[model samples]
Target chain A: MTETRGEPDVEAWAESGGRERAAWIGWVTFAARLGLAGVLFWAGWTKFTEPVVLQRQAVDAYQILPEALVGPVGVGLPVLEMVLALLLVVGFATRLTAVISGVLMALFIAGIASAWARGLAIDCGCFGGGGPVAEGETKYLQEIVRDVGFLALAVWITVFAPGRLAVDRKLGL
Target chain B: MGKASRERSARERIAEQRKLEARRDKQVKTLAVAGGALALIAVAVGVVVMADAGKDEPAYTGPLAPTSRQDDGSVVMAKEGVTAPVLEVYEDFQCPACKGLEESSGNTIKQLAAEGKVKVVYRPFRLFGQDPLKGNSERAANAALCAPGDNWIKFHDRLFAEQPKEGKVGFENADLISWAADYGVSGAAFESCVNNGEKGAQVQAMTDHAFNTAGVQSTPTIVLNGKNVTDQAWSGDDLAKAVQEAS
Candidate 1:
């Protein structure tokens, strides 16, 4: 099959530098995929048990979105997070999921930044239960930094496709 | 290049095209299945959420009195003697700042109310439901409204006095019942009302009023004659002075 089929380009590439590079990329991809999956899983799972109420409060506290948008965002965000987590964990449509994950992280970073700039004294509500932070307990800087770190992981996964053990690769994405 | 090699390359190109098409087919199939699964999960979650949104709250049949309810169903803590110039004090039961505001100026406000100087209406405003405190503010507010007649004020004051510390459970049903008893607001009817959460709707309605209608962002927002006095620290004689000025 190897002789009959058209894979000389792959063979030649493998012979040159592709084998070592692919192996390196695979390990990095695996680690990045698992890392982001763990984050989304933890974040989404925390809110799932409690359901929509606190999530709504968190959304309201941002004070950025319109009233009409609040209910849908509050109800839908955690579900999306969990769905994205599942996709990331199983490495299905890895590039698409990773891009989404990156977008979410970027949004979180922006939200926290805006809240901090506005002197809102909010809890970032990244995992859940976000509203006005308890008095004198504002941690906006730390929240922003952590979200930035998550954003970096997401960006890496987006670019590299996380091909190792990924359903995307199996489907030749 | 030789003819044999050229032919082999052409054949390889055809095979590559076939492989690419097969890969695309697989990808399309995977995306379709994944999208369907995601939609199914989303629909399931939406249904569950919608079902929970339907409150099992029993009707507020506990007690009835001559209390004035605002447009949004928030009860106005209306006294008989005072008629004009409503002194609206927006407060949350669990908010520490509100507790402070009440502690500092509660007496002055009560004295003014007794004197019929200003009709003080304690509007229930909630915050901190999403935190570890959960829905305690809303629950306490509900319990306050559920208190029979003039007993709501007493219940309101006592709640602030025994207001739990920040980042803690503010009040449970049993605690509310016991406190109501302490404030001479006890009975089987009242207990049933609190337990059954009959006034939960009223509580939610009032909270929405404070947030949406009144544009109340935080607790302890003091308004006299519809003028906001939230910026001023009316800690001492200033509170009485402000009330007097409003009149």
Candidate 2:
């Protein structure tokens, strides 16, 4: 394709240190994607190791979803998390995976916010094994902050489209 | 020579463009397939787990069981002539606080039941500890359900008596069987019942009932006439007063 008059010139930009800047963004994106993947994998693995019933009960404690949906949501969530983590790690379908990750995080944030608002003393169940928290042990603020941080990473990956060492690069994504 | 070479170069550029387009199409196709497969696998896992949800073990048909089982899977103990209001006690054996409740007021409550002053209904609420499936709370609840009500109560007391610290594997399967024998619930049939964990499903159901139906969250939840009197823990006099007030 021919560059328009006002369009940035790749050759000229490279001569003006744009190469180092692009590499810098690529490396940062790579690190953020890897970090998010690691977090999701660890969280999913913890929940996976526990019984599916435990997960169900944890969701039941939330009392947010209808009883029928609880079973499917509880069981599917950790598996989905692990799958998304795997794709992110391998850099396959990075943008799509990031969108899913963002959606999940947003749902979680809403769940936590409601629980906090309602004065329900329950664990967020982010990693695994959550239920009613004992009196004076709720950590809603910290959990929300952490999830928001992860959501930020998800948004960044989705928008910036990290390329270095990614399957997306090879696939012309 | 120059004209022929230029013409060949132009043809090569067109071929290269076709290759790039083909590669892009193939990559999109692969990604779509991979994404779809991953989603299908996730849905399959969820369905399989949900299918496994209601898999109850064979119902308990052993001896010394409850005379009347509640609809929510809890066992009821009603003295022959007791006409007093029912005192529903929700407890988990692995809970130290539950043990504290039992140690301080277990005898008082049993005496009340013995005297027919109050019909104490013991419900196994297995909310204590981390592991939902293999936790001591579930194991002890399962063992208790296998035994008859009278023997179960005896075993229940002994369980609290030998309650291990939280976050520890105190109720080994073999040890549970042996303890049942000590509580006068012995023999091969009883041992097999405990070992096989036939009432595993019932225990799980009871746990769910405690949470979903009864709305009881923690252990040692004393309900007098369906009103939670957990504030009256560790004090027999206070619990008795509350029960009296309720009646």
> Which one is best on lDDT?
2
Per-candidate Cα lDDT values, in order, are 0.71, 0.73
Question: Per-residue CA lDDT of candidate 1, range A1-173, in tens?
Answer: 55553345543443355678877767787798888888887887776654344566677677789967766677677777887878887788676788888999999889889877776767877787676666568998888889889889887776666458877667555
Off by over 4 Å in 2: A1-17, B1-27, B30-44, B47-51, B54-56, B61-247
| Clash tally, candidates in order | 0, 2
Strongest candidate by DockQ: 2
lDDT measured at residue B11 in model 1 versus the true structure, 0 to 100: 100
TM-score of chain A of 2: 0.89
What is each candidate's DockQ, to 2 decimals? 0.05, 0.06
Query: What value does DockQ give for candidate 2?
Result: 0.06
What lDDT score is found at residue B138 in candidate 2? Answer: 75
Docking quality of model 2: it rates as: incorrect
lDDT tens readout by residue for model 1, B126-222: 6665655546787787788777655566677788877764455668899999989986878888888888888877877777788888888877688
TM-score of chain B of each: 0.67, 0.67
Q: What are the runs in model 1 whose C-alpha is more than 4 Å off?
A: A1-17, B1-247
